[model samples]
Target: MLINEGNTNVFIVTDAVLNKLGIPAKVTDYLDAKNISYHVYDGITPDPTFNVVEEGLRQSIAANCDAIIAIGGGSVIDAAKMIAMSQGNKCKPQQLIGILKARKPSAPLYCVPTTAGTGSEATLGAVISDDKTHQKALSIDPRMVPLAAAIDPIIMKGMPAHITADTGIDVLTHALEAWMSANASVETDYYAASAVKSVMHYLPLAYKDGGNLKAREEMGIAAHYGGIAFNKAGLGYVHAIAHQLGAYYSIPSWSC
Candidate 1:
């Protein structure tokens, strides 16, 4: 779907684990069949730092990639957003931090979320950590939103139980925070409610049986809905404090 948007050379962004596992072959194989040019940069860490973004941007620029595709969880997606935006603006990733900092929209960005959590693919924000301090900085721009995403359950079927549980709780947190925000409205309420209900029901089934395609699909949708809800309605203290603590301690959200 992304290549159909007229992108020629592509830059594939992901973590070392996913790259080593050869999970990106899911997309690369298709690209190969279609004769699309692409380069894979798999240096993203769990909490990506500005250095990581810089390295990715450098590689993508050197490869002359016109499009960016993220194929991992939240951290990978976030890094891809910054990489695309920086490449589009012809600047460093650190310079793009903060609200509405970009002079133009990001380069065409697409996502294949291997984990049904964080929903970074659906949102307009990306968080990049400081190289030395590990403190997170959020960049918000409508341009940061991906052009498209694939939430294939087959891709998620290999996720371990612990990650599934952790990400499911993250989905629930996003929905609840959005619903409770003072900025929430009728439109946000619909998405938030749907996500909350789906997580409450399908999370357990997905956790119990990773091969349950129906459960995986529902959770994936729920995570996307939660992201949309929060994107519009906003989030609260849970995210406010959790983000800092997670960045500070190098832990993921909901681990405590």
Candidate 2:
């Protein structure tokens, strides 16, 4: 339900990498064939700053978009989440930079991930950096979660080895942290274990062969389960330290 078939305007959010790979075109072509009006904001960066969210917001509002669809990996999805969240809250993204700070629900948001990383499509949290200070600010509102997501292996089969390895490791980290969480429940344990097992079996295959659809599918499902586990159980030192590294060094979260 990302876009209505007719007479609907959508703001498509993405990044340069996905645009270069023509991932957004998949969605745009569908929209085009269905006669769904869409505007594209593809300026999102790796660590997504408040400024990037604002520029996207400006374009979205100018277009009077009724829905938003994000197509890419974590950065693109996270930026789109914040843009949608900020729209409904009627405030700057920085204002809602803490636990459940958003006063209103987000605008309609959907995700189509291009990599088996971050699982931003299934999470309640999004991170944005301060344009001025370069420090990371987090927003953890259930409202920010995407309304729906499309996990297609065709989109993920093109990932480079380094990224596949990095994100696969990142997926393992998520499950491990979730399983170790103090708040972890049996529900979280099941998903965490499933994700860990999937990574153990499939990560090497995907890393060695990007075109392996089965491996790509497993990695994507592993990431999704990792997100589900962590969403409830929360994360541990890995994410915290990763955040610090990302803030200080400008490293992407999926980087190992």
lDDT of each: 0.93, 0.89
- For residue 170, give model 1's deviation from the true position in Å: 0.3
Lowest lDDT sum, 10 consecutive residues, model 1, at 247-256
Residue-level lDDT of model 1, residues 8-74, one tens digit each, is: 8999999988988889998899999988999999999887889899999999999999999999999
Q: Give the alpha carbon lDDT tens digit for every residue of 1-256 in model 2.
A: 6544233889999988778878889889998998889999989999888889999999999999988999888888999999999888888888888898888889899899888878779999998988678688988988888988989998999899999989889889999999999999999999999999999999999988899999999899999999999999999988888887887778796662
lDDT of 1 at 134: 71
> TM-score winner among the candidates?
1
How far off is residue 209 in model 1, in Å? Answer: 0.4
TM-score: model 1 vs. ground truth? 0.98
